[model samples]
Target: MEPKNNLRSLDRQINVFLPAISLICILCIFISCNKQDRTTVIYGKVTDQNHQAVDSILVVAGGLWDFNIEVVKQIYTDENGNYELVIDVPKKYIKLNV
Candidate 1:
């Protein structure tokens, strides 16, 4: 019958479209759940007790979150004892080690 054929066509279309729409919705949820990362810039000069530039020194920058320290950047001082570090972390308590 014509009505039975119409029902079969509708069912076929639903079976094909439902899964595609569900996949798109699931992807949107996952994309919205992602968080963007933030960054901080640190610039300083390293010097010894005698006020002399300390070059080639290792400098580490870390962020303290939830009682955990996560290292974000590690760099060495330049010949002029100047160091620049870009850290990707949240704005919070941070620790520096030289």
Candidate 2:
């Protein structure tokens, strides 16, 4: 009788622990897969052919990735005509619309 009772207790413990362990493993995998991608900074100055800093110019980063024209990020040139944008995109072919 004692042996039978011990077997049942062990089975119950395993049932509870197994489900918890499986849940933790699944959560870890989900978190790792959805991690944020690395970003690249695009900083430059906007100017006309006359070679002057064009202040207040709107800088746009747009392109079609996976068949869709999208604007990843935008920034306005400062007094020095300098703009910076940190965006996460593939390094294939992105359009720089200034």
Candidate 3:
């Protein structure tokens, strides 16, 4: 009867710790499963055939993922003819059209 009582006590202790252990494991999995966004910034200057700054020129950037083309950004050149395209994608998947 004493051994059985000890076993029951151990079982209760294990049950008490089980929820904490499960919560810790779930938290670890949640932390590890987060995906980080890889952002790439493309900087360029739009120019004309006469070697002049082309302001307000449309610059389009897309991401090639699998068989689909995702339009990442569409922006115009600033007053200085400079354009900056910030994309939340890897460099390998980026395509620019100016």
Measured against the true structure, the TM-scores of the candidates, in listed sequence, are 0.52, 0.51, 0.54
- Name the candidate, 1 or 2, with the larger lDDT value: 1
- lDDT per residue (tens digit) for residues 1-98 in model 2: 99999999999999999999999999999999867575768899888899898899988888666666778788899988899998777655344433
Q: 1-98, model 3: which lDDT tens digit per residue?
A: 99999999999999999999999999999878765567778899988899899999988887776667878788999988999887777655645443
Off by over 4 Å in 3: 1-37, 90-98
Superposed by TM-score, candidate 2 places the C-alpha of residue 49 at a distance from the truth, in angstroms, of 7.1
Question: CA RMSD for every model?
Answer: 6.1, 5.3, 5.0
Model 1 weakest 10-residue run by lDDT: 89-98
Show where candidate 2 strays beyond 4 Å: 32-41, 47-52, 63-65, 86-98
lDDT of 1 at 68: 81
lDDT per residue, candidate 1, 6-95, as tens digits? Answer: 999999999999999999999998878755466668899999999999999999887676688877778999998999987666656554
The number of the candidate with the highest TM-score is 3
